[model samples]
Target: MKRTTVIGFLGSTLDASKQDAARWNKWRPTVGLCMQPDLRVDRLVLLHGRQHEGLAKFVTQDIASVSPETAVEPHTINFDDAWDFEEVYTELLDFAERFEFEPETEDYLVHITTGTHVAQICLFLLTEARFIPGKLLQTQPKRGKPDAGGVWTVIDLDLSRYDSIAKRFAEGSRTSTSFLKGGIETRNAAFNAMIDEIEQVATRSSAPLLLMGPTGAGKSLLARRIYELKAEQHRLSGAFVEVNCATLKGDNAMSALFGHRKGAFTGAVAERAGLLRSADKGMLFLDEIGELGLDEQAMILRAVEDKRFLPVGSDKEVESDFQLIAGTNRDLVRAVAGGSFREDLFARLNLWTFNLPGLAERREDIEPNLDFELKRFAAAEDTRVTFNKEARARYLSFATSAEARWDGNFRDLSASITRMATLSPDGRIDRPAVEAEIVRLGNLWAVEPEQGTDALAEVLNADAIARIDPFDRKQLSEVIVACRRNPSLSATGRELFSVSRQQRTSTNDADRLRKYLARFDLTWSDVS
Candidate 1:
């Protein structure tokens, strides 16, 4: 059985009775605590000043007579005054530090009933802060019945069990979620729950967190909010550094992420402190992480594991202890299968992966977000703007309807609101403005075949673009565009070869599209 050890102050003032029998039998808290039937106090460390030596001895004798099993040890501690908060606290804290503890084989309790208010507070602080590995035990004497005895209770200082404390934590999480959503009162329970979890992780952990979602799903926004929250709480001291991996390319990517010495590369005129170093003791938000090359991924893995990495052209390794938050729209598991992303790196970051819902998945949030966007616009432009009753209802109706596909998610909504607010006469958005904005959004969302060709060409390498004949380029562009708009290969292929497929006896549209994509080693993951 584990031994119960009690550490407390000498009750010199409380147990100052002149009569021997009265001193022993009186309702002294420390002695009364030992009198409890169920509690077996194996040892007691009574702290006292030199003047209280006699008192300590008397108390020890009293305890020994009642409970002989308890080994009472009186410890001499110097103190000018028990009421001096700092002096008492420092001495007690030092005593706690120097005292040998066998926590694995013994349970410890700090008796708060015998000490002064200051001494009791200090003991409680020490225990609560984990400076002293023990729970608090308070003994209450029976009122008007000295012989009737008192009650003793053990207090575990875990704030999570308390309803008010838990509610406060929940409120903080809601505030953080609001910060991420640009002050929007988000009504979607699923999205709110996800944000709550993210806030918890952000507050408690420094682990690499992976945010997986569709484009414009608030990953970057949430990551920034997490950094801001940490900074606000003084948990982080360094600047928030962010980089979109999709925009990174070749030597520039390396030089940009890991610092480069002077003359590291052709145009390297001066030494540069990269994004990693800039984010030391802070946060690093890597957006569109799927776009990072395998070599960069390997370097990042090493950096994440051990806060050290070699610069672009330097042999010496630099250190950057940073918390990582990575965002990606790609299905990384599929990317791992396609041999594009590193499996080990994915495994490391996947530990804290959170999938954020796209706007279409949480359409209920659109109405509130609409108001949020207008407010944001008003703040930015220094002009108040509100939609008229009819106009507001109409916009919300269209936005929440099945026809309104929020392809760009919150980004599209913000832009739509900004345009309307800018064009609105005075501070009010009329019906005409709302109608025009809806048409504008509809036209923008409509995927034109020619526009898809432009987008595909933009992503393609110069060499790959040059290799394809003009005729094949036109066909490939249209096909790629179709693939992007449609979720499945069958849908895209049928649309692409509608005329040609009909001419054939039987059409294997998906197979045909797959073969065409194979010419460029492009898979569904690469296109969509």
Candidate 2:
């Protein structure tokens, strides 16, 4: 059985009475705590100031006379001002840190009846944070009897222990998850689970988040949604600032991100507070973060870690406390390996990395997302649009089928919906509209295959092409495109094996290309 240990401040006024034989008749909280028959306190750790030493001794002796089995240990904890929350909290925190907690062998209770309100709040925080492993012990005087030993109640901070509170929390989690998904009622289990985790992380942490996916896979939209969610929760106060790093070039990149002093460069007519500064106390979404220059990447790393960076042509450093959400379609790990991107910056952003899948990967969710797209279109255009049963069936069948490449992911879906909606005569999309849209998409997708087929025909015969695996044919077609664009085998190899070359001590681009051509029963000369 674990022994019960009570820790509390010595109540100078409440525990004080006449030092006479009649003093035993009055009830003191510290004495009353030990006097409880059901809640046996084997140890009492009394916290008090130096001036209250005499009162502490008196209370200790009084508690001992009644409960001789309880061992009383007095600790002198001085507070500059008992009501000063910071001072009191720091003092108590230090005490909690220094104290040896035997949680397994002894049950600890923080007696909230004796301390100042500030101290009580600090104790509650410490207990909730698990700095002090204990429950709160609150005491009240017996009804209409000021001098009587009070009734005690133990309050547990763990919310999961309370069914009602736990249910409310569960409901709140569902609401937050829904909000993150833009209330789409997404059908994909993996996507829904990812959104749930993103919701939790968005609300709980201010750390930088990395959203990586292919183009138009909703990285930018998701980053904005995160900002909006955090704003709704009052976690951020400033405006959401977004910038495409691909658009920022040369000296403009530095001035655009870290701000610039007057006369910083040729375009410096006035001092500019850049996107990072503009996003203070809020979030900064850097779309296409992999496109940023190495110099800018270095500055971003410093700003992210220290929240302080020197502006362009400025000696002084400025601070901006902004959360970062970096979005990229490019493979940053590959970029880092290729020496195009800073490894340290990648390391910092990789801490909370989440890879969002493309539309092709989440085909099951197309139906619900179709409805969401139509709703968005209705709101944006101020005109309602609906697909007839046959049209909806035709569109979904194509959208979710293997024939649809969906190269641009959600953007492609949104655009397809917008086009169909605009073409609908009486706000009703019919089979004709769906068939026309399908033909248009098919023509768009055909452009790539036509190019690939032309390239492959130049190198191999129809029989040779038929022998190649479909997967290898597609990949080889892309390789042939790269080879034709470049002038030589070495240049083409560098473009294709940019990431893999970094792993080797000796990079033989020409030799590697020659071998790959050999696998296809051809020479570089045959293709080039």
Alpha-carbon lDDT, every model = 0.85, 0.88
Q: Tell me the tens digit of each residue's lDDT in model 1 across 1-528.
A: 999999998877776667555554467777777888889999999888898898788778878888999999899988898799999999998998899998999999999888788999999999999999989998887767565147888998877878898899888777876776668788889888888788788888899999998788889888988899889989899989999999999989999999899998899999999999999999999999999999999999999999999998899999999999999987788678767899999999998999988787788999888888877887798899998999999999999875677778789888888999889868999888989998998898775524656546544666888888889888777777666555578867776778998789988999988988888878766775
Encode model 2's per-residue lDDT on 1-528: one tens digit a residue. 999998998888888888998776677788898878788999999999999999998988888888899999999999889999999989999999999999989999999888788988998999999999999998877777455477899999999999999999999989988888888989888888888889989999999999998778899889998999899989999889999999999888999999999998887999999889999999999999999999999999999999999998899999999999999976687578668899999999998999888887788988999999999999999999999999999999999986787766898899999999999869999999999999988888656534577667657777999999999998888888666545578878987889999999999998888888889997776665
Q: Which residue segments of model 1 deviate by more than 4 Å?
A: 1-66, 71-134, 138-154, 160-163, 448-528
Report the alpha-carbon TM-score of model 2 versus the true structure: 0.85
Q: Would you estimate the TM-scores of all the predictions?
A: 0.69, 0.85
RMSD of each: 7.6, 8.9
Using TM-score, give the best candidate's number: 2
Worst 10 residues of 1 by lDDT: 449-458
lDDT of 1 at 128: 95
